[model samples]
Target chain A: MELLLTYDVSTTTPAGRNRLRRVAKLCEGYGMRVQKSVFEIVCTEPELLTLIDKVQRIIDHDEDSIRIYRVPKGSFRTVRMFGTAKPLPHDDALIL
Target chain B: MELLLTYDVSTTTPAGRNRLRRVAKLCEGYGMRVQKSVFEIVCTEPELLTLIDKVQRIIDHDEDSIRIYRVPKGSFRTVRMFGTAKPLPHDDALIL
Candidate 1:
């Protein structure tokens, strides 16, 4: 399954800044960083659990926020793009 | 339709910071800010177009990016949340 992970790690303190870096590094191991704090990951249920566990350990529950969303198949078609980033490549039909 | 807009407006320069603030302010007019730079908006196609137009004018094509994603119906069920933010309410089986 494809998952989109979005997070808001407080940076008001030095420890919070470090946690932000650690969390981003952990997620980079599993997915592509589509936005500064958003990642697009493709993995199995077990893998997802492991990633979630690591993130849980790194964040302060009362100070940070994290949300993981499952992206349904074919959702690429619903993305509309603008600006510098490449619109995610999509090729639904191509006859040879 | 429901849309999720994510943006990365360069903040290294004064003008970029201004653009970031402006872009965020504009999005706030139409939706809820879910993350530091992400918004969840519920609106019509024409409304979306107006928003897209405004955002386009504020960003620097070579330095910033913006992406709008359409949220599929029932996607709220797919959200797995953690931390300070409230898990969005899901009442799929509520009988009361």
Candidate 2:
């Protein structure tokens, strides 16, 4: 599955900044960064669960927002990009 | 349907900035802004089509990227927010 992960981590405090960095790092391990706080992760169902669990643990449930949108494989057909950043490349090259 | 709209408008030029403002204004007419470049909109299929068309016109497809994620209605149950911004309000109060 292809998952679109978007998050907003509160950075009002020192701890919040740390959390933000940590979450970004964790996401990098799972997929490529599409935007500053957005990532395109291609993984299996179990991997998705683990990713969510790890992210949920690092975030302050009261001060952060995280959403995971499950994108069907090959759904990029509906996507239109008109910028430097190309759409997710095809090929299972991203699968772990 | 509930749609999550995210976009990255290039601001390297004066024209790009104008495009950004125009696109944002168009989105405001459709739904609530969730982040700087993110919005949560509740609308029907026709409304969604209208939004895509208007946005496509305002953006420089070669320098901007727009993504519309179709979120199933009542799917907010899986959404977790831990910040000052609450989730989309219920009650179909936004239907047009």
Which tens-of-lDDT digit does each residue in A32-82 have in candidate 2? 766656677778889878888888889888877777766656655455444
Candidate 2 on B1-96: residue-level lDDT in tens? Answer: 766677776555799779878877787777776665667777888988888888888887777787776665664545544444467654553544
**Where does candidate 2 stray beyond 4 Å?**
A9-22, A56-63, A82-85, A93-96, B10-22, B60-62, B80-85, B90-96
Q: Highest lDDT among the candidates is held by which one?
A: 1
lDDT of each: 0.73, 0.70
Given candidate 2, what's the lDDT at residue B80? 43
How many steric clashes does model 1 contain?
0
Please provide, for model 1 over B2-95, each residue's C-alpha lDDT reduced to its tens digit, 9 standing for 90 to 100.
6678887656589988988898788877766777777666667888888899899989988888877777665555567788856444323221
C-alpha displacement of A35 in model 1, angstroms?
1.5
Which sections of candidate 1 miss by over 4 Å? A11-14, A76-78, A87-96, B76-78, B87-96
